[model samples]
Target: MSEPILSARAVRKTYQSGDRRIEVLSGVDLAVERSETVSIRGESGSGKSTLLNLLAGLDKPDAGEVIWGGGLGLDVRSTFLGMVFQSFYLIPELNALQNVLVARRIVGGIGSAERARAKDLLARVGLAERSHHLPSQLSGGERQRVAVARALMNQPQLVLADEPTGNLDERTGDSVIELLLGLCADTGTALVLVTHNAAHAAKTSRQLFLHNGVLQSAPKPIQP
Candidate 1:
């Protein structure tokens, strides 16, 4: 088998609430292969987001490590990782086109070709006509589509999405989900999705339940 694009080894995390210590993740491990999709579902406060953060290098594991592309020293923000959150993190001041360009800028290779790619991504997400509009001018689903475009701007090998559909209504959420899955498939980007939606989780290649600060295989979801 090909090497996994990302892996976590015996990861653990903890937090302090007032005077009490809370263990959020305990010896968690996971691997994501190229173009593979994995979904994690858990109750609120089950450390789902924390795990994603650790995997993305947004946070450090208290006891273990996360490795990307077979190493531990990679910069998550560079070309290796992309993140989408429940709240659209688009800049209010930047238009959709410019917002997508931000990722390319982050990796420090801005030019006409990259600009063209950004515009193409906007069109892929059905935002070509809205590319000049600000986040406030777009609908919630439109904004999230822009977020998806931004996430792909750097051609990341892995995309870590945290409740990407949490804020939208069911119909809109389904569309966003379809768009997300379709893009990831087309780009061969490994996806690590953290969501509470069982139906969404079921669509992935693997479904995991996070409980007691650990991850376990979830039952196979019934197919229609």
Candidate 2:
């Protein structure tokens, strides 16, 4: 078998609340293989987002280690991974196309090729006509679509999405989830999604529930 794209080795995290130190994650382990889609579901405040932050290297674990298979070092970290969040973190001044191109900032200077790639990604996210529109001009769903395009702009091997659909309506959320899964599958990108929606979670190749700061297998839902 091939090595995983990401692995969390007995991760542990804690936070101080007044005089008490609350343990958020206690020795959690996870591994995501290439081109695989994995969804994590848990109760609110179950440390789902915290686990993602740890996985993305945005936050350090109190114990254990996160190993990225690519081993690209800190300099190329942006190239090795992509990320999506509950809030659409687009630049208000930039258009949808420009927002996507921002992901290439670490790569090199933007050129015609980069611009073209950004356009293509915007189109893939169903926002081709709105490519020139600013985030302020877009609807909630449209904004999130732009965020999705931006996440894939780097052609990252893995994407860590935390509540990507949280702000959208049910129908819109469902569509976003579908698009995210399709794009990852088409690009052969590994995905670790943290969501609260059961139906959305079931769409992934694997599902796990985070309980008591540990991950447990979930019964595979029937595929449509």
TM-score quality measure for candidate 1: 0.96
**Stretches of candidate 1 exceeding 4 Å from the true structure:** 221-224
Please tell me which predicted candidate would have the highest lDDT against the true structure: 1
Please write out the lDDT profile of model 1 over residues 94-160, one tens digit for every residue: 9999999988887796899999999999999999999999999999999999999999999998999
TM-score of 2: 0.96
**lDDT on C-alpha atoms for all candidate structures:** 0.92, 0.91
Model 2 over residues 1-224: C-alpha lDDT tens digits?
89888989999999999999999999999999999999999999999999999998889999999899745465656888899999989999888888899889667789998889999988899999999999999999999989988889989999999999999999999999999999999999999999999999989999999988998897555678
Error of 2 at 72 (Å): 3.6
Provide TM-scores for the models: 0.96, 0.96
Against the true structure, candidate 2 has what lDDT? Answer: 0.91
Superposed Cα RMSD, model 2: 2.0
